[model samples]
Target: YKAFEPQEARRILDKLEIHYTPKHGSWLNMAEIELSILSRQCLDRRIPNQEVLKNEVAAWQDKRNSISKPMEWQFTNQDARVKLKKLYPTIQQ
Candidate 1:
């Protein structure tokens, strides 16, 4: 598909006022880890169809929810400011 023109993209972004994290950032890394775990633990076998896939995922979710534990996210904004400082724009004092 053709990409959006720069002006159009900028206009949309301005309208949405969306906040986005950088690629390979901690949030994205955590999401990738979750998806990898789901794929390995719940979707290791071939799913014959979308219906089967949906049912399988639902069952997996039910089982997971029953035994779910809170995730401990260690990364903090302060940590990001220190470790990923290069990715952020400089602040003027």
Candidate 2:
């Protein structure tokens, strides 16, 4: 797949005929990123026993999920295109 533009990326995906529902809509990208961070922070340490690990993880999960809030998204494709205009190619076709 090639992407000369964002539309080209969509076109190549359509050509492949891969049907997918974007989980969490556009938040899928950020959710994946946050999961990576959570995995590293919460699960990266080695515990001596499963019970201890579970208890510790439960505490961490409760603390995190209780206060966690969804991110505030502001930019759209058009907004990004305007602010980051220099990063994109001028030609679409």
What's the C-alpha lDDT at position 52 in model 1?
92
**Which sections of candidate 2 miss by over 4 Å?**
1-27, 79-93
> Compared with the true structure, what per-residue lDDT tens digits does model 2 show for residues 1-93?
343788888777678865564554375777686678678888897789999988888887788789887666677779889999999879867
lDDT of each: 0.81, 0.76
TM values, all candidates:
0.50, 0.44
Candidate with the greatest TM-score versus the true structure: 1
47 Cα displacement, candidate 2 (Å) = 1.9
Distance from true position, residue 81, model 1, in Å?
A: 2.5
Q: Residue by residue across 6-89, what tens digits does model 1's lDDT show?
A: 888877778885566655457777668778979999899888999999999998888878987755768888998999999989
The positional error of residue 25 in candidate 2, measured at the CA in angstroms, is: 4.1
Superpose all Cα atoms of candidate 2 onto the true structure and report the RMSD in Å to 1 decimal. 12.3
